[model samples]
Target: MWTGNFWKQAAERAVKTFAQASLALLTGDGMGVLDVNWGDVASVGALAAIASLLTSIVTSTVGEPNDPSAVRRTNP
Candidate 1:
């Protein structure tokens, strides 16, 4: 979590989560595009992103110390 690479990966995961959440909000229902609630979409996206970040932090303990995304380091 202290390393730049760890932060970078966390941010990437958050952004991806946000994008996916937003897309789901936009397309999941039969509502027309114009009827979509932008505020709700943004809120959901933000929440999902935060959740992703939290997940990264929680999982960091088991991974390589410097890599938040790595579950474990393998021997060569």
Candidate 2:
């Protein structure tokens, strides 16, 4: 049930959330290591998952998906 806007919104929301979280950490003047669970960093988790999933999907669907899509031109 995802339109193109779904991906767009999700990306924007993630960026904003991450920015806010970063600001919070920086402003706290060394919140310091308290051994936290860090569930709020879902943006990072989502990014990692997306990267891995896309890598697998592309690699499986097409050979060498990470490679450049180009046609070699031979000099005459």
- Compose the digit string of candidate 1's lDDT tens values, residues 1-65: 78889899999999999999999988897689899999999999999999999989988887788
Q: Cα deviation in Å at residue 50, candidate 1?
A: 0.2
Q: Please give the clash total of every predicted structure, in order.
A: 0, 0
Model 2 misplacement above 4 A: 30-76
**Highest lDDT, which number?**
1
- Relative to the true structure, how large is the alpha-carbon lDDT of every model? 0.89, 0.46
Angstrom error of the Cα, residue 22, model 1: value is: 1.0
Q: Any residue pairs clashing in model 2, and if so which?
A: none
Worst 10 residues of 1 by lDDT: 65-74
TM-score of 2: 0.38
lDDT of 2 by residue, 1-76 (tens): 1345434544554555566665565455455545433564455555654654444434432432232212234579
- Candidate 1 TM-score over all chains jointly: 0.87
**Model 2: how far is 52 from its true place, Å?**
18
